[model samples]
Target: MKNTLLICLFVFAALSCKAQNIIPVEDFFDYQNEIPDGTYIKDINNVLNKFTGTWLGSYDNKNYEIVVEEVVYQSQIRTSLTYDQLHLRYKITDANGTILLNTLPLPDDNDYVAMGQYVNPSGAYQLDYAGYEYDCGQSGTLFIKTFNDNTQMKLYLYLGESPYNEDDCPNGFAEQEFPTNSQMLLTKQ
Candidate 1:
């Protein structure tokens, strides 16, 4: 009789407590429930974020320092914006500490920048922009390869411009040869 009475009293107390305040159980399988309010998720893209920063390297007896500045991705869809475009400006000085190449853009030049970005998930970002020459001819392409957790980078420039000496040769150039063919290995500074 005492055991039955005790069981009945325990059941009554549990029912009364549940009736006082109730808490809804979250569904464990729901994806949205896992993320709490006032938090966000970043879209991890294999593009500009990894490659943008100051990098140091050397090529042709010159020490090079380049900055991969991120530019806004202007798209029709507002939600799809990211640091997709990049301005790969650099400052290359000779071993003697004399400046050889410094094309680093000023901060105010955001209206019209140098380079645009194309994605390469496997290795690098294919950048299409005007050649780094005042009068080479026209536009060109830059292949910026990155590795080692964005600590290392390699830049290969393939300029698509014609020779000014059209009269001297009288024949077209056999292959695509740039006046300034360059390859650089750089590390993030």
Candidate 2:
């Protein structure tokens, strides 16, 4: 009887450990509750659909303009948008035809995660690389206005202070006030 009880306790402990590691799908869908009942939901989906492609833009800092290109692709229906940002040097491709400076795949799966910001109907948000969770502290709205089938404009607004502002790298850049608009001209490939 004692041996059986010990085995049960060990099983219970093991299950508890596994539960701690499990991330529920609901956590990632927290933004769903913020969506309005009617028209807003469809509007969100429309904006997200427009985001599926390659976007190229430049950030000018007086003297130097860094040409940045971002390639975004949707995963399976429920999967998060996976993307990579590359510096457009002389040529775009790496030795293996992959984009240069591509982000390494996350350990959870063989998928590359985007750095900087990601905006969906759920809201403008930032993903935590170390913990692999959607951070509530970095919430904002990404307003995307479609001009046509080929042209769209994006405005990213951080509702509050940006969580990344404290760091010194890309993750640490300061959040701009509302209407920090950036335009992208996408040529579907």
Candidate 3:
């Protein structure tokens, strides 16, 4: 009788612990018709794993260094859903080795940090980018595509124009440290 009671208690305890439902990262949008409130959208195929690491590149005499990392169970921007996403931090330096812009020291939640949004049908990864100068229209969508056996990637920025009062700018808008509407090749370091 005592053994049976212990078994029942153990089963009850096991049942009491709720496990989170896991959905493959690729299937995130397919479930839009029915919202899976607390499900985890994960990279079960390890696609994003290959992109996690340091990438180095250069453009117009400026050196760019980006670090990619996977963040698991990150809460969605405006919902109860959680998912695994890529986090990007970068540092740009001038030809003379002077720092132009650096976001490596910022926290993951900082506005300057780029957050992964989704992968498109063409297998290109998209991320929401907000630079330190976002208030002046330095924010946009960033696209990354892996190539050459995942050792190289192409980074492109599509700047989204933000509406700001004309009076805010006395000397006009400053050019982005990174390229806008163009792509740069990066090699995994």
Candidate 4:
């Protein structure tokens, strides 16, 4: 009888722990739909405006430039939080006046706006770029941070170890035995 009682208590404790760990259904779909309401809302514009104008950088012995503008995005998906998220729109170009990047991934999409700083105070105002693809898996994340005071900007691109799922890798898309230029450094133009 004592053994059965102990087993019952153990089962109850296990079930209680499981119930505590079960997250709510909505918590699983925690997507960044829009900027959350906060006390620092007023300062967001000034921070965003700092990204405007032209910034230059280089990759693969070639030159590139980024242009930022504050504009009104068309209001679509009326009920969605991202329907009219106000922020800086970026345009990237090369020396020969070739469009280098867009919002979506493309052959020439070397740079584009990824997202905005949601929490502001200690959040990252990040961007994504096709940091110079040697093979299929050639994407990287560019972090924008305060370079020389609040006026200037510094852009750093970090290429993770994971390459594309291309058939180039003999053993399931692994990195080759060559030096991969995994980091890019740039300053505001």
TM-scores, each model vs. reference: 0.56, 0.30, 0.84, 0.43
Encode model 1's per-residue lDDT on 66-180: one tens digit a residue.
Answer: 7887665433434433333667776768789998656675552432235644554455666654533323343467778788887898887666564445555445333321224
Each candidate: what lDDT? 0.57, 0.34, 0.81, 0.43
The residue pairs found clashing in candidate 4 are 137-164
Ranking by lDDT: 3, 1, 4, 2
| Poorest 10 consecutive residues by lDDT, candidate 2 | 58-67
Instruction: Estimate candidate 3's alpha-carbon lDDT, on a 0 to 1 scale.
Output: 0.81
Tell me the tens digit of each residue's lDDT in model 4 across 1-189: 999999999999988865544332123124345333221122323445555566656665445554544433322334222221123234445567677543323322123343332223333344434433434554445555554554565555455444565466444443321124443344565
Clashing residue pairs in candidate 1 are none
Would you list the clashing residue pairs of candidate 2? 124-140
| Candidate 2, 1-99: lDDT as tens digits | 999999999999988865543322223344433422221111222334444444433222111111223333333443433333111211123334554
Q: How many clashing pairs in candidate 3?
A: 0
Question: TM-score-based ranking, best first?
Answer: 3, 1, 4, 2
Using lDDT as the measure, name the better of candidate 1 and candidate 2.
1
